[model samples]
Target: MLMEELPPEAMLDGPPPDADHLLQRTLGTVREERHQAVLRRGRITAITSTFMVAGVLAGGVWLGHGPLVGGTDDEGEVLQGTSSAGANMAVKVTETEGGLRLVATVHGVPDGAACWLVVHTKDGRSFTAGSWRAHAGEVTLAGSAMVRAGDVAGVSVVDHDRRPLVTAG
Candidate 1:
């Protein structure tokens, strides 16, 4: 007698061994490659960003420290302050209609007192600009210092003995 074929009901209890686990593994490799690519891009971006920041800082420092035409550093400005260096004197050197001129003014004088304008040149010459015997409770003088490049003109308030009370810078 021929062997009777098993009924289809016998196969209904289980699935076939046809699942593609190899395909899942290949997909996992693809995902890992994609993740590595993203990491590489991020590293490159960070390096480039660091370089850009350093460049900006260096440029700023150079411009601030480098000397340029018509540019004066802090030291130069301090030396130029108040027009001269002497007693608490303040002078203004300007070019007026007559040419280079200097004007000196002093205030806070004693009531009913007087003051004089003293002018000195770097060339060992001294002259008096003008004198005022306390007018309007203030003393002021106008004088010109010899104009020389890099030269300073000083104006100072003088007392009875020609002693500088407050020298103009």
Candidate 2:
């Protein structure tokens, strides 16, 4: 008879042929491929995390120490001052048509202390440029004086009680 008609105990079979080897090989290949895919994803994640961290650090540094944040200008005159009370200041004086524009960065002052930015003239006159409550860290103040930049003798930071914190010429 034909093969289809000769199936009752005619085929070679005490048991079905073992397919364990084939199955094992197929499973092993699948496992290896999965492992490789996981490794690739892990590497990509690691690299992306590294770049993100580096970018944040770089931005922090730039904002912390850059000329814009530090209140420095190439065209403005820079003055440095310090006080016996451990306060420090850097003043950038720029000449404007109406007056002298002052940008001052002050540090080492007590938090919540009321302070003033005073511009001292060579003629022994003082003009209050700006005022603010001092914070713990660095504080930036901006003010304008009616005097010309050439007439400026110095700049000072004083407390609410007119106590001098720092002065820079």
Candidate 3:
């Protein structure tokens, strides 16, 4: 009879066939390649996401409008005030066509207390930027001074008695 006419059991009555081994090897290779491809795609996706987040943060900083990154100070310097009497303050000095632009923030100051901004220069000169009474909460003050660049040594927040409530540089 022909090989095709043999019974199903007769077909496996010898040593394990070479065809089965080859098929198994081929299947294993295919599975491994598929797994590797999946891993590669995952890694690529992770890297791409990280880059996207970094780009967004950089853009926000460049725009000069984000938490911890406000008002452009490219042409000036930023000074942080030391907390005194339970109040915190910060100052930013920016150069303008007329002179210097001063921006100040005071927080936790005593309510209704008179507070003044003092700008001290490195050349033994001092100028009062502005003054205001603190509110129940935080307060922001702005002013301008006709001072030269690189001359400002520090800034101070003083009470009505001229006692420095907080100083910063």
Candidate 4:
């Protein structure tokens, strides 16, 4: 029955049956057209699905985990360096969301003023992080950038305080 939906082959075994010849011709043409339309629709659907899948894959790749930079702190063994955070510079690193969050208490920067966080990995990979302006007591740096595995994550300021400021713990 499904094959009946398809157009018959052009080759006839012998002389073509004369029964309803014209009607059969019309039906054949219509059937062939319907089959062609179905095929075209199927191709379009396949193409659309492929594109959707590709988009999801590309997005997943782009959303891959960011490199993490973290080190174990012993508090006492670590050196509490001067804050690059300016005046009342008090930089605190806390464990939040399985990542080290750098929070600073500075006196100079005003609310809405942009502040840049410079981070460095153990492999010497350094990059600027998402900016955070002074909000209330401190500015929150981005939390998504993970601390590199088996390495220390260092943080500093730009053009303000370059004092190798890291409290080694």
Candidate 5:
């Protein structure tokens, strides 16, 4: 084989073999790709957060209106009463497992007055449902009676001294 050697000046010839432009192009492409990746991550995070908030709101609505939290409608029979002393009482009676449940809303009674709820049965017997201390505005109290709801002939509220405050049948 024949060997030929080029002069050193030939290597240093034209544009100094520029590589800065190639390096800049490579760096610019890498920077653009990084920016695009960051944008994609931000978009994904925003979408996921929106869905999570929507799901939480839907669950809250379902819980609020569901039967587990008690339906919106009032249940049982409602009775009203007003006494000569100007006291008023409203009672809602519902039949329960072995007796009757009562929710009473009493008004126009003196504050801090001890009151009792008495239930009279059709069989000529009286039963005390519960008692409480009256407060301002409408006072709501809950009680239960051993008698069935249908057997209740009347209901009354009395003071600690047994003076009738209100009565309803």
Candidate 6:
């Protein structure tokens, strides 16, 4: 009955030596530890790669659709005017980091005519924002000036001779 409980190999020579048993158990433990280490390393690599991809995608989105120069509200204020020569003008002013940015568009201007844009403040201050040649159908011009926010009160379009052609609030 006792011999039936023992394996055929263990039945030989009163069983295997303790050294062989210890060596086999130790090798099994080492293999298990090695497998666990490999799994831990794989998990760490996967997590790091996921975070790196997410960071790159976030940065791309920020650079693509981020805020403009002065933050929101690209179109600040639009001023409409009609010149004595029947030309219609529109000017838009928006805030910027340093000062202000102005855009002027004029329609029905005579060809070869020089025109300028003037920005006026509430404190009776004026500045020539920009100038351009007036076209027959339309003329567009842009400029920038250093001024505080909410300081501008009006805008004016002038002819080549510095004559005020149109004014608007």
Among all candidates shown, the one with the greatest TM-score? 2
Q: Please tell me which model should have the higher lDDT, number 3 or number 4.
A: 3
Better of 1 and 4 by TM-score: 1
1-169 per-residue lDDT for model 4 (tens digits): 7767766663457565785797799999999999999999999999999999999998887555323234333221111234444433445554433545555444445455556655567777755544555555644344324554235455554433433322221
TM-score per candidate, chains pooled:
0.38, 0.56, 0.54, 0.34, 0.55, 0.55
In order, what is each prediction's RMSD in angstroms? Answer: 14.6, 7.3, 10.0, 12.4, 7.8, 10.6
What is the lDDT of every predicted structure here?
0.55, 0.86, 0.81, 0.52, 0.84, 0.80
**Model 5 lDDT vs. the true structure?**
0.84
How many clashes show up per model? Answer: 7, 0, 0, 11, 0, 0
Total backbone clashes of model 4? Answer: 11
Cα miss at 126, model 6 (Å)? 1.6
Q: Tens digit of lDDT per residue, candidate 3, span 66-154?
A: 22223345646779876746778888888765567889988877788888898889987889999998888878899767786578888
Once fitted onto the true fold, the runs of candidate 3 whose alpha carbons sit more than 4 angstroms away are 1-74
Give the lowest summed-lDDT range of ten residues in model 3.
Answer: 64-73
Off by over 4 Å in 2: 1-73
Task: Count clashing residue pairs in model 3.
Answer: 0
Q: How would the candidate models be sorted by lDDT, starting from the highest?
A: 2, 5, 3, 6, 1, 4
Q: Quantify how close model 2 is to the true structure by its C-alpha RMSD in Å.
A: 7.3
Best by lDDT: 2
User: What tens digits encode model 1's per-residue C-alpha lDDT throughout 57-146?
Assistant: 999997644442243332221111222323244455553323234455555555455567666556755566667775443334555433
> Which residue pairs in candidate 1 collide?
84-169, 89-167, 89-168, 89-169, 90-168, 90-169, 155-168
Q: Please, what are the lDDT tens digits per residue for candidate 2 over residues 30-129?
A: 9999999999999999999999999999999876443532244467799998888898999988776567778899999888989999998899999999
lDDT of 6 by residue, 1-169 (tens): 8878987787577545797888899999999999999999999999999999999999998764435465675657788888677878888777776777777887876777787888889999888888887766777788877876599888888787877877777
RMSD versus native structure for model 4: 12.4
Arranged by TM-score with the best first, the candidates are 2, 5, 6, 3, 1, 4
